[model samples]
Target: MTKRTALVSGAGIAGVTLAYWLTRGGWQTTLVERAGDLRSSGNPVDVRGPALSVAERMGILPELRAVATHAKAIRVLDSTGRSVARIPMSSRNGDIEVLRGDLARVLWSAGRDDAELLLDDTITDLRQDPDGADVTFERAAPRRFDLVVGADGLHSTVRRIVFGPEREFSEYLGLYVATVQLGGAPAEPDEVVLLNVPGRLLALHPARGEAGAAFIFRHPEIPGLERGDAGRQKQVITASYQGIGWRVPELLDRLEAADDLYFDAVSRISLDSWSRGRVVLLGDAASCVSLLGDGSTLAMAGADRLAAALAETPADLGAALRRYESGHRRLTGPKHRHIHRAAGLLVPASRFGLAARNNIARYVLGR
Candidate 1:
């Protein structure tokens, strides 16, 4: 019997894991990523619930546990650098918290032996037919696959070409976020220090003597900010966070000096359905509640479920796709609904909201 074939766009968590499972199920998988190389820097993410089960089955759980973020607690502070609350994280942070890059690397290392990975390439166009989809790449030659999965994340090119324009499906959750590496470390390697003011949050998370700093704030979309221009985005961040106290001045100085910065709007992706014919969506491309939604774990679990469906119905591609969508939707919807509330908790839009949150924190996380 001839093996089936799949092309997974985006080499992030979802894409890599999907490729891993597909190959394990005796399918030929081709993974494409637009970036020149794997992304090696990102904030820590959790692996919990069904995602933990999937990791255990894949035999990568031990590796994940080894690299888990060792941050002891999430320390909250006022604008004046005074500690207001210290929240213990071990109980509710799920099975483990691993840096995003480390998780991706683990997925890649486990799956690379079984699949072909094409870096520095993207799917420029995709044409679906009764049999399969004809794919055209920006730099590579065209090819046909039995199925295509868009695990490309928030602004997925596959989703745009297959489903429709991104704006139609994505709704801004009233905030923006940026993360940059700091030149000088501010906190211990095992601590997450956060300072919150009305509508803004500045956090410094140190790992292995290096710190990754983040700026999240409530703001309307800037006209030219969506283009990923680091200069314009930095200016907006500096302007928005101006005069804010508690080590912000030092962070802003580092932000200006940093050359590589990751910036994007904290938004949600909602679609009526996640598949169209042989083309389907996974991870953030299908339903994203941003980072707060525990997207990394969901992506890993989605890949596991999709691969299971395909393995069960290897001969029936359409039926397998439908099965994957049906099972995955139940897991994503309820989690997505809580994003607005999560936004309020992380970056309150009003002074009243901030004060109310602080009081509750003090009551629960009393020092």
Candidate 2:
């Protein structure tokens, strides 16, 4: 029997994983990424619960474990760089966390033998028919696929092309995060230090083995800041905690010198259903709970579910899409809101909220 063709958008963890599994299931897989090549960012990520099961199935669990960050346990602190509370992560069961770069590499390397990866290209225009969808790429000729999946992430182009404008479903979770990598090494031992102030949280996470440094700062909201301009986004974030304390001054100096920075308003993607006809969504493109723990894991789990569904029902694309959406959404949808609410308390709207949170941590949540 002739195999069906599947097209996946975005190259981040979700898209690539889907392409990987679809290939194994005897389907022709093509992944188109907007970026010229694999970014392989070194952001820290975790693989928890059944996510490990999927990795095991992918046969890369051993390699992923080898590259796991074994990040130092999380430390919560006060404004003056003083430790206030701590969470022992080693206590969690069956949890494996690794840098985002490692996972991306693992997924990419795993799929290299089975899937067709299209880098430096994008699906700029799409048209669907009763039999299939016709996609026009920015760099390639038009093509038809039995199905299209959006693994493009929160600002999913596939979602926009198939669903609608992004703003309709993505609600800002009342905070923004500015993350950057500094080139110069600090003259001190690297550690994760979190310092909280009213309506903001500043954190310094030293990169593994002194490769570089990572800084994260959070604020409730920035009303008029232009989100599209990268330079301006960096400026607004730097101004948010202009005089935070201790190493902050030196850190900002390093940030200005740094060229590559990652910044985004912490937000979640909410959709009633991931499928609209033959086109479906996955990962952050479907339900992004930005920067929250386990969200990406959920994305990976969704990829496995999606590929399995397609494998089981390749002859009927409609049945396959419905099955994938039903099973996967049941597991992931509600968690989106839970993450949003928790983030709100983590970085409150005012001084009162901040104090209340610290008090709760010191009294109620403390062990």
Candidate 3:
């Protein structure tokens, strides 16, 4: 019997996690990434729920837990730097949060031992047939695989090749965020300081005594802000938040000089289906929850399900793809809705709106 082969696009969290699982199930897997190596500078993200169980099954549970950031505080604040509330961190609560770069490194380190990873390459065209997919590459030679999976991110190249344009499914969440590593520390220790003004919020996530700040601001659909013009994007963000209270002016000054910037709208990807023929979508490529929700957790969960389904159906690749989509959609659909709903509840359009949210948070949740 010929060994089954699979191709996974993008080497980020989803692609690497799926590759690791497929190799364990006796499938020969190859991964292609646009980046020369793992881009390990992403911000900290969370991995929770059944996803943790999936990691434990791979025997990397203890390793991930050991490197957990141990984030002990989430502080909500006003424009004057007054504290609103602070949420505590504990393993007993069941959420494991770590830096996105760190978690991707962990997954890749484990998966690379079992899979063939082609760095600095990407799939340019995908033509699927009955038995296999003929994949065209940008640099390397074309290859065929029994199955292809898009574990890439929101701007997934694989998704465009297999599916149509992104605008058809992406729903803008009415906000934009900019994140980058900085040389500053938070005003307080272990504090997740979030300063909220009208239609905008800037947060500082305390990490190992230093801090990484994230800026989220509301807008009315500004186009062409993402044309690889980091300076222009910074200008637009700065102009939008001009004269706003809080430490935003200082934050903007710091952001302007920052070399590494990740900026995008807070949008979610919703698709009627995540699988077609032998081509399937996983993680942010399939379902993205932007900056407001537990998208990282969902991505890990989706990757686990996709890999498990493929492994369970070692012989029937098509059935495996279908099962993966159904299983994952079931797990993420509710949480997706909850997050979008909570977005409006969290990001206020006015001072009264912000106050209402705080009152609810203080009285209802009593945080």
The C-alpha RMSD in Å for every predicted model, in order, reads 1.5, 2.4, 1.8
* TM-score, ranked from best to worst: 1, 3, 2
**Tens-digit lDDT track of model 3 for 49-71:** 87777677777777777777646
Q: List the residue pairs that clash in candidate 3.
A: none
Q: Across residues 171-255, which tens digit of lDDT does each residue of candidate 1 receive?
A: 8877888888785554667778888999999888875456888899988887447676788899999999999976788779989
Model 2 root-mean-square deviation = 2.4
Per-prediction TM-score, please? 0.96, 0.92, 0.94
Give the TM-score comparing model 2 with the true structure, all chains together: 0.92
The top-ranked prediction according to TM-score is: 1
Give lDDT: candidate 3, residue 136: 95
Rate residue 313 of model 2 by lDDT. 77
Candidate 3: residue 251 Cα off by (Å): 1.4
Clashes of each: 0, 0, 0
Give one digit per residue, the lDDT tens place, for model 2 in 1-367: 7778889998888888888888888889899998988976666678888788888888998998788764555566777777776655572666877778778899889888888888899999888888889999999989999889989987899999989998888877767766665544533333455677776676655545443444434555665453577778767777877778866777777777777776676677888878877799999888888465576588788999998988787678789888988898777767764775677566765678777877777676553
Q: Candidate 3 regions off by >4 Å? A: 364-367
lDDT, candidate 3, at 70? 40
Clashing pairs in 2: none
